[model samples]
Structures are given as structure tokens and as C-alpha cells.
Target: MKLIRYGEPGHERIGVQINEVNYDVSAFGGDYDESFFASNGLARLDEFVKANAGNLIAIAEEERIAAPFTRPSKIVCIGLNYKDHAEETGATIPAEPIIFMKSTTALAGPNDQVMIPRNSKKTDWEVEFGIVIGKKASYVDESEALNYVAGYVLHNDVSEREFQIERGGTWDKGKGCDTFAPMGPVLTTADEIPDINQVGLWLKVNGKLYQNGNTSNLIFSVPFIVSYVSQFMTLLPGDVISTGTPAGVGLGFNPPIYLQAGDIIELGADYLGTQRQEVIAFQKN
Candidate 1:
């Protein structure tokens, strides 16, 4: 099952995507948030789709696409989880997972414009795979981690190098800017993916390929990451965990390239679907 939200930003309605066409399922009486997932929402949603059959209304072709689900309680990220990415950025292999939190307010629709924060010149892009939790998880065993997962998503881990590295105490300063976390044209349920560990992930800017990598290259596996994170804090239903990106971020370049107004970023992962966002200059009030 592929879940989606579509409407006018904050006014979005719940929907389902089947074979590329989206259909209205607002009658299900739930948003894809923590409350909905904690109560077996996915299973109930699947039943609803099965029972509704042809009665589900088809969304108009011109309707806007929002995030697949409502904002999660948190967006936790793993840094330097990929070998090539670690090497490219001049970092050593970590003895433990490097964790960071991105502000929830940074969430934006997949196709929305990415705002270049005012006074910024080091804004960059990272294409990564994201995990959505289905139930409360705390101190979970690595072997049992997958049981708590609801779905997977495509994430663009947009960043500002200056605020993150040079000017900073922590990466969050650069990571939590408005429009920095563009995610999901669709959220594919765990069952849809054949082998989650072997997924292909890629990214392009202005039609030029920049990131070409695979999940198979990850230094730490998904279950380990989930288990490791759960040990420190409870991961609630609807919370997202971005696995980390492979090599080819702008920060990895010889002189380092950065995003500017009018640039376009497109990214996707196997079975998770794709996203496209235009870069727009920030405006002050």
C-alpha cells in the first residue's frame, strides 16, 4: 500500500496511490499521524481500500501532492553512515552512529520549492532513504527492529555547510531551516519492497546526475540503526529516521558546489517513489 496526502498544503486530504493513480480515501477518517498508526491504521486502511473498490474517488490530475503522511514527532538522522560519503567529506568511520535531529517544521511537500535561506551561500543537497515508524519502539533488539516499521520514504537532506560545520556547535543549525527536508511523493509500505537492503538510490540537479548509489553500500544496516536509536529515546509512530546519504553531495566536490536560486533537485529510491523541487530565493518579512 502506498499512502499519500494531497490538497492545498495544510488543508491536505488523505489518499492512496495504486498503480500510479491517486484515489480519495478521506472517508477512512484518519490522517497518517501517530494516533492513526498506533491503532493499526495501515491494516485498516488496506481493508478500506479492498472494500471500497471502484467507489473510491479519483483525485483530479491537477491536485497538489503533499507529504505522504503528516509530520512525525521527530526526524532523526544518522551521519556518515555510508563509506563513500564519509570519505568524500573527510570524516573517519564512526565507532558509533552519529545522530542528529531535524526540526519538524522543516517538512515540505516533495515537489515544493526549496528556499535558499537568506545570507546563505553553502546550501547543499543529500539524497537519502527514510524510515517511518509504525509503533512505539524503545530499547528494541536489532533483530526485531523491522517489526516496528510502517514504511519507507525518499528524503532530500538539504543542508547549509556554513551553519552546519564552520559556524556551528551542531549540525541542526544548518539542517532545520524551512523547506530543507523535502520528502515523499508516496510512502510505500514495508511489504511492497522486495529486499529493503538492496535498494537503489539516486539524485540529480538541473538534469545532471550527481548522486548514484545504493543502500547496499551503507556502513550500518537498517535494523542496527533502529535498534541503536531506540536505546536512547522512544521512537513514536509517525517518527522518521533518515538512514543517511551515499557519496556525491555538493560538499564532496573539489571546490564544493552549492545550490542557488533556480536550481532543481530530483531524487528517488527503489520502490519508494521520486521527488522534484525547484530552488527559490528566501524573502525576509
Candidate 2:
């Protein structure tokens, strides 16, 4: 099932897409948050969809969408997990994952404008696969890591290169700006995907293809990342873990291109769905 949250920014209603139409399911009494996914609300939602199939309200085309899941406990990211990406950055592929955290407040809907922070001139784009946790996970074996994942979504790991590499102590400084993390068109359940590692992931800026790669090239697979992070911190339901991006990021270019106002970014993964966002510089008051 393709689950979505739509309405206004903070007033989104949980919904399910049925036959190309969005069925408003918010009346079932739960937000599409950790509690909903963790407590088997998806199953309950399925039952509700069946029982009220005829009466389900269809969402308007103009409705604003919020991120598919509500507030999450954490947003963990893996850096340089792609061999080619590591090589492009002149860094050695790590024997283990290079992890970082993005403040949850950076989260926004997929189509939202990427607000280029004040005095920033080096904003860049990274199209990546984001994993949504379905259960509390701690000290999990790599073998059982995928079991804790609820699904996957498209994520833009927007960055400010200057702050990230030149001016900062950590990558988080350039990463956690408001509206930097644009997630989803919808959250797809794991069962819908046939092979996670082989999914085709691609990105286009203003209709020009830039990042074109597949999960098959990832240095660390999804299951390994989930299990790897769980060893150090508890992975709770609704926590997001963004697997690293493959090559062809703006940072990997010969003069290094960066996002400017009016640029449009479109990206997606197989079975995860697609999303687009327009870039805009933040205006000072």
C-alpha cells in the first residue's frame, strides 16, 4: 500500500492511495507517525479501507503534503557509503559506516522549497534512499536488520559544501538547515520491493540528469546499515536512516556545481516513488 500524508503543512491528514486516487484515512484516528506504524496501524488501516471502501473521501489535487511519517526520533545518515562517491571525494572507502545525524527539524515535505540558509553560497544536492524504522532495534545482528525496517522513500541530502568541508567541525553543520531534508512522495512498504539492492536511483536538476546510479553500487547495504547503527544507539520506530548516495553529486563535479534559486530537483528509487522540489534562497527579513 502507498501511504501518504496530505493537507496543509502542519495539518496533514493520513491517506492511502487506491487505484491512483488518495483515500482520506485520517478519521481512523491516528497520525502517520511511529506509533501508527509500530502498533500495526497499517493492518488496521487496511481493514478500514475495506470496510469503508465506498465512502472513502478522495483528496483534492491541490492539497499540500507533509512528510509521509510524522515526527521521528532521529535522522541518521551514512557518509561515503558508495565506492565511486568516496573515490570522487578523495577519501578511502571505510571498513565501517561513517555516520552523522540531521536534526529532525530539518524535515519537510518532498515538494517543499529548499531554503538556502543565510550567507550560504555552496548548497549542493544528494539524492539518496531513506529507510524508515518500524520497530525498536538495539544490538541487532546484520542478518535481522531488514526486519526492523518499515519501508523506503526518496531523500535529498542537501548540503552546504563550504560549511561541511571547509568551515565546519562536523558535516552536520552544513546538513541540518531547515528544509534541507526533503522526504517522500509516499512511504512504500518493504514487501512491495522485489530487490532493494538493485533499485534504480536517479536525480535530475531542472530536467537535466545528474545523478544516475543504482543501489547495487552501494558499499554498505540497507540491512548492514540498520544493524550497524543499532549496535551503538537504539533505533526506534519512525527513526530514519538515509543510506549514502552513489556518484554524480554536485560535489563530485569538475568545478563543483551547486544549487541556485529556481533550480528543480527530481529523484526516486524503484518501488519507493518519485518527488520534485524547487530550490529557493532564504530571504532575510
Candidate 3:
């Protein structure tokens, strides 16, 4: 099922997309967050849809779309999980998955304006396939990892090279800027996707292709990532794990290319849906 949250920021209401049409389901109550998923919200949503089909309110086609789920507990990411991406950044292949956390404040709607962080001149982009944890998992076996997954969403892991590299610290410094992580046209359930590892994904800057990659090239598979991470910390329902991006980031350019005000970013994955964002200079209130 294609689940969505729509309306103005902070006021979004739950909705469902069926046969390409969107219908409001807020009457059923609750935001799609950790508690919702922990209680089998997806299954309940399915039941709700079936029971209220004719009574469901239809959302206009042009209405704004928000992220399918609420702000997760944390946005975990795997760095250089793709060989091609590692090579492009002149980094060695990891013996184990590189893990980092993105601030929950970075979360934004898929089409929201991407504000270049203040004093930032080296902003970059990464198109990643994101996993949403459904069940609480700790010390989960790799073979059973998939069972804990709730669904998937397309993610743009925006970064600032200076803070991440030049400033000397974890990638978190560059990855957690407000509006940096624009995610979701929708969060599709795991069952909706035929093959989790075979999805094709791509990104473009101002209509020019920059990233063209697929999950097929990932060094660590989805099940392994989930299981690997669970060993370190409990993955709660609604927590997001971005599987990492393939080659062709701005940092991979010969002399390096970075995002500037007025640039447009378009990215997505198969079955996960697409997103578009316009770049703008940061404004301080």
C-alpha cells in the first residue's frame, strides 16, 4: 500500500493512495509514528481502508504531500556501502558498515525547499534507499532482519563537505542540517515491492543527471544492515536506516561541484516514488 501524510508542515493528516488516487484517513486517528507501527498500524490501516472505502475523503491531486511517516527516533545511515561510491570519494572499502546518525530535525517533506545551511559553501547530495524499522530489534539475526522491516522510502542524504570532512568529525556535522534530508513521496510497505535489492534509483541536479545507481551494487544487503545495526543498538519502530548511495555525488567531480542557490534536485527509487526540491540560501529568523 502507498501510505502518505499530507497538509501543511506540522499539521499533516494521514492519507492513503490507492489506484493512483489519494484519500484522507485521518478520521481513523493517529500519526504514522513509532507507536503506530509497533501496534501493527499497517495492518490496521488496511482494515480501515476496507471498512471506510466509500466514506473516505479524497485529497485533491495538487495538495501538498508530506513524508508518509512522522519524524523517526533517529535517521541512521551507512556511509560508502557502495564500492563505486567509495572509489569516487577516494576512500577505501569498509571492512564493516560505516554507521552515522542524522538529526531528526533535518527531516523535511520530499518537495520542500532545501535551504543551504548558513556559512556553508560545500553542500552535496546523496540519493539513498531508506528502510523504516517496524518492530523493535536488538541482536536480531541477519536471516530474520527482513521480518522487522516495516517498509521503504526514497531519501536524499544532503551533506556539507566542509563540516563532514574539513571540519574533522563524524559525518553527522554535515548531515544533520535543517531541510537536509528530504524524504518520501510515499512510504511503500515491504510487501508492495517485488524484490528489495533490485530497485533502480537515480538523481539529477537542475535536470542534469549526476547519480544513476541501483541497490544491486550495495556492498551490504538490507537484511545484513538491519541485523548489523541491531547488534549495536535497538532499532525502534519508525527509525530510518538509509542504505547508502551509489557513485556520482558532487564530491566525486574532478575539481568537485557543489550545490548553489537556485539548483534543483530530483531523485527517487523504483516503487518507492520520487521527490523534487529547490535549493535556496539559508535565512536566519
Candidate 4:
């Protein structure tokens, strides 16, 4: 099922998309968040859809689409997991996955304007597949990791290269800016996608192709990442695990190409839906 949230930024209502038409499911009685995922809420939602198949309200065309889920406990990201991306960044294949965290405040609607942080000159984009955890997982085995996943979403891991690299700090410095992580048109359940590792993902800036790659190139794979991450820290329900990006990022270019005011970016993956963001300059208060 294609689960969604639509409305203003902080007041979005639960929705479900079927047969390409969106229907309001706010009657289901709760927001999509950590508690919902931890309690097998998807199954309940499935039942609700089945019982109210023809009675669900059709959402108005003007309503805005927000990120599919509420603010997660955290957003964990894996870097250099893609062989091509690792090679492009001139880094060796890591013996294990490289993990980082993006501040929860960075979450924004899929089609919202991307804010170029104040004093920023090296903002960039990364098209990646994201995992939504279903249950609390700690020290999980790779073989059992898939059982703890709720769904997947398309994510643009926007970055600031100078703050990430030249500033002499962790990548999180450049990655956690507000609106840097614009996710979803919808969150697709894991059952809907048969093989998560074989999907194709791509993105473009100003109508020009910048990232065109597939999950097949991931060096560590999803199961390994989830299991590996659980060993050190507990992964709470509704937390996002961005699986990293493939090559063709601005940082991978000869001279590099960063985002500027008025630039339009579009990106998507099969089954995960698409998103478009218009770029604008940051304004100081």
C-alpha cells in the first residue's frame, strides 16, 4: 500500500493512495510515527482499508503532501556504501559500513523549497533509498534484519561539501541543515517491493542528469547495514536508515557543481514515488 500524509507542514493528515487516487485515512485514528510502526499499525491500516474500501474520502487536489511519517527518533545514514560512489570520492572500500546521523529537524516535505544555508557555497544533492524501521532492533542478525523493516522511501540526502569536508568536522555538520532531507511522496510497504536491492534510482538538477544509478551497486547491501548498525546502537521504530547514494554527485565531478538559487531538482525510485524541490537562497533573521 502507498501510505501518505497530506496537509500543511505540521498538520498533515494520514492518507493512502490506491489506483493512483489519494484517499483520506485520518479516521484510522493516529499519525504515522514510532509508536504506530512498533505496534503493527500497518496491519491495522490494511484492515481499515479493506473494511472502508469505498467509503474513504477523496482528498482535495490543493492539499500539500508531507513526509509520509512523523518526525522519527533519528535519521541514520550510511556513507560510501556504493562501490561507484566510494570510487568517485577516492575512498577505499570500507571494511564495514560508515554510519552518520542527520538531525531530525532537517525533515521537510517532498516538494518544499530547499533552503541554501546562510554562508553556504557548496550545497549538493544525493539521491538515495531509505529504510523505515518497523520494530526496535538491537544486535539483530542480518538474516533476521528484513523482519524489522516497515517500508522504504525516496530520500535526497542534501549536503554542504565545505562544511562536510573542509571544515574539519564530521559529515553531520553539513548534512543536518533544515530542509536538507526532503523525503516522500509516499512510503511503500516492504511487502509491495519484492527485491529491495535491485531497484533503480536517479535524479536531475535543472533538467540535467546528475545521478543515475541502481541499488544493485551497493557494496554492503541493506540487510548487512541494518544488522551492523544494530550491533552498536538500538534502531527504534520509525527511524530512517538512508542506504547511501551511487556515483555522479557534485562532489564526484572534476570541478564540482553545487546548487544555486532557483535551481530545480527532481528525483525518484521505482515503487517509492518521486519528488521535486525548488532551490532558494537562505535569509538571515
Candidate 5:
């Protein structure tokens, strides 16, 4: 199922896509958050959809589409997980995953504008595949990791190069800016995808193609990341694990390129859906 939430920024209603039309599931009484997915809510959601098949309300054409889930407990990111990307940045491949976190406040709907923080000029775009955990997972085995995944979504890991590399700290500062993580047009359940590893993923800035790559190029695959991350930190339902970006990032360019105001970023994965975000400079009151 392509589970979705749609409406204004903070008031999205839970829904699912059927025959390309959104079927309202708000009557199920909760946004698609951690609690909902953890308590076997997806099964209940499926039942509801089946029972109310013909009665479901069709979402209006004007309503906005928000991130599929609300309030995820964590947004963990893997850095330099792709071989081409690691080589482009001139960084050695890590023995293990390079993990980082983005604040939940950074989360926004797929089409939301990416607000460049005041005085910032290095904002960048990273198109990645995000994993949504289905249940509490700790000390999970790589072989069993995919079993705990509820679905996948398209994520833009917006970054600030100077703040990330020259500011003398973790990547969080460059990553956690508001609207930096534009999540989805929809969250596709695991059953919808047969092979998660080979999806075609790419991104564009303005109208030119920038990052063009496939998940098949990932050095450390999704299951490895989930199992590896869980050994140290427990992963809760609705927690997001972004599987890192591929090559062709602005940082990987000859002279390097960065986002400025009025830039448009668009990205998508094979089955997860597509999203577009406009970049706007921040203005203080």
C-alpha cells in the first residue's frame, strides 16, 4: 500500500493511495506516526480500506501532500555509504557506517520550500532512500533486518557544506535546518517493492540533472545498516534511517556547487514516488 498523509503543514490527515486516488483514513483516528505503525495499525488500516473500499472519500485535488508519517522518533543518516559518493568527496570508505542525526524539526512535506538559514550560502541537496522502521528492533541480525521495515520513502538530505565540514563538528548542524529533510509524496509498504537494493534514484536542481545514480551502487546495503545501527541504539517504529546519497552532489563537483535562493530541487525513487522542493533564503522578522 502507498500510505500517505495530506493537508496543510501541521494538520495532515492519514490516507492511502488506491488506483492513484487518495482514500481518506483519518477516521481511523491518528496521524501515521510511531504509535500507529507499532501497534499493528497498518494491518488495521488494511482492514479498514478493504471494508470501506467503495465508501472512502477521494482526496481533493487542491489538498497538499505531507510526509507520510508524523513525528518520527529519530532521523538517522548514513554518510558516505555509496562508493562513488565516497570517492567523489575524496574520503576513504569507512569500516562501518558513518551515522548522523537530523532534528525532527527539519522534517517537512515533500513539496515544501527549503528555507535557507540566514546568512547561509552553502545549502545543498542529497537524494536518498529513507527506511521506516515497523517495530522495536534491537540487536537485529542482518538477515532479519528487512523484516522490521514497514516501508520506504524518498528523502532529500539537504546540507550546508561550510557548516558541515568547516564548522568543526558533526554533520547535524549542516543537516538539521528547517525543511532540510523533505520526506515524501508517499510511503510504500515493503510488500509493494520486490527488490529494495536496485531502485533507480536521482535528483535535479533547477531543470538540470545533478545526482544520477542507483541504490544498487550502495557499498553497505540497507539490511546491513539497520542491523549495524541497532547494535548500539534501539530503533523504534516510525524512526527514519536515510541510506545516504550517491555521486554528483554539489560537493563532488570540480569547483563545488551550492544552492542559492530560488533553486528548485526534485528527486524520486522507483516505487517510493517523486517530490519537488523550492529553495528560498530565510528572512528574519
Candidate 6:
């Protein structure tokens, strides 16, 4: 099942995509948040969709789409999980996954506008594969990692290079800006992706492709990442764990390229779906 959430920004409702058509599943009476995942919601939602197949309303083409699930407790990310991406930035391969956190406020719709934070010049993009936890996990074993995964998501790990590398602090600052974590046109359930490791992921600025790589290049496999992360902290249901990006980020270029207002960023992964965000200047509130 490809899960979706759509409507006005704050009033987004539950939905499911079938045969490329979005269908209303709100009658299932769930918001698809932490509680939903913790209580076997995927299986329940699947049954609901199947039971209401003929009666579900098809969402209009113009409705707003948001991340498939409501904001989780956190958005955990891995840095340099791809060997090529690590080398591109002139860094040694990590002995273990490099973990960082992106603030929940950073969450935005896949097609939402990506705001360049104030006083920023090095805003960059990273097309990454993301995981959605199905249940609470703490010190989970690698062999049991996949059992805790509900599905996968396409993530735009938007970053500010200067704040991330030169600001002398954790990567979270550059990574946690509002609108930096646009995710999901749809969330593809785990069952659909036969082999998650072989999936392809990519990104483009405007019309030209900039990042194109596959999970095959990952230095740490999916199960290892999940199990590894669980060892440090408890991952709640619906938590997002971004698996890191591949090579071709702006920072990798001899002369780094960054985003400017009016730029378009598009990214996608197999089964996980695609995301399209427009770059916009930061607006003061």
C-alpha cells in the first residue's frame, strides 16, 4: 500500500494510493501517527482499504499532499552511508553509521516549498531513502530489524553546507531548518519492496539530473542501520530514519553549487515515490 496524507496543510487527512489514484480512507478513523503505527495500523489500514474498495472517494488532482504520517518523535539521519558520497566530500568512510537528528519542525510535504533560511548561501540538497518505524524499538537485533519497519519514504535531506560543516556544531543545525525535510508523495509499505537494498534513488535541480545512485552503494545495509541506531536510543513508532544520500551532492563538486530562490528540486526512489519542492527565500514571521 502507498499511504498518503492530503488536504489543507494543518488539516491533512488519511489516504491511500491505488493504481496511481489517491483514495479517501478517512472513514478508517485514523490520523496515521505514532499511535496508528504502534497498534498494527498498517494491517488494519490495508483491510479497511480492501473492504471499502468500491466506496472510497478518489481525491481530486489539485488537493494538497503532505508527508504520509504526522510528525514523529524525531527524524534521525545517517551521514556518509554511501562510500562514494563519503569520498566525494574528502572524508574517510565511517567505521559505523554517522547519526544525526533533524528537528520535527523541519517536516514538510514532498511538494511543499523549501525555504532557504535567513543569511544562507550554501543551501544544498541530498536525495535520500527513508524508513518509517512500525513499532517501538530499542536495542533491536539486525536479524529482526525489518520486522520493525512499516514502510519506506523518499526524503530530501536538505542541508546548509556552511552551517553544517563550518559552524562548529552538530549537523542538526544545518539539517533542522524548517522545510529542510520534505518527505512523501506516498509511503510504500515494506511488503512491496522485495529487495530494499537494490532500489535506486535520484534527484534533480530544475531539469538536469544531479544525483543518481542506488542503495547498492550503501556502506551499511538497511538492517544494520536500523539495528545500529536502536542500540543508542529507543525509536518510537512512526519515527523516520533517513538512510543517507549517494554521491553528486552540491558539496561534492569542485565548485560547490547551492540552491537559490526559484530553483526546483525533484527527487524519487523505487517504490518510495517522488518529491518536488520549489526553493523559496526564507520568510520572517
Number of clashes in model 1?
A: 0
Better of 5 and 6 by lDDT: 6
**In angstroms, how far off is 124's CA in candidate 2?**
0.5
What tens digits encode model 2's per-residue C-alpha lDDT throughout 1-285? 778899777778899877667778888997988788789877788899899979999999888877888979999999999999999878889999999998898999988888899989999989899999989999999989888988888899998889888995999999998998999878888887888989889899999998888999999999999999999999989899999988888888888889999999998878777788999879653
- For candidate 4, write residues 1-285 as lDDT tens digits: 989999998789999999778899999999999989988999999999999989999999778999999999999999998999999989898888999999999998889889999999999999999999999999999999999999999999999999998898688999999999999988999999989978999999999998899998998889999999999899999999999999999999989899999999999998998999999999663
Report RMSD (Å) for each prediction in the order shown.
0.8, 1.3, 0.9, 0.9, 1.0, 0.7
Lowest-scoring 10 consecutive residues by lDDT in candidate 1? 276-285
Residues 38-148 of candidate 1 have per-residue lDDT tens digits of: 999999999999999989999997898999989899999999999999999999999899999998988999998999998899999999999999999999999999999
- Model 1, CA-based lDDT: 0.94
Model 1 residue 82 CA deviation (Å) reads 0.7
**Model 2, backbone clash pairs (residues 3+ apart or across chains), number:** 0
Ten residues in a row with the worst lDDT in model 5?
276-285
> Looking at candidate 3, what is the lDDT of residue 157?
97
Error of 3 at 143 (Å): 0.6
Where does the lowest 10-residue lDDT sum fall in candidate 2? 17-26
Clash number by candidate, in order: 0, 0, 0, 0, 0, 0
TM-score of each: 0.99, 0.97, 0.98, 0.98, 0.98, 0.99
Candidate 1, 126: how far from true, in Å?
A: 0.5
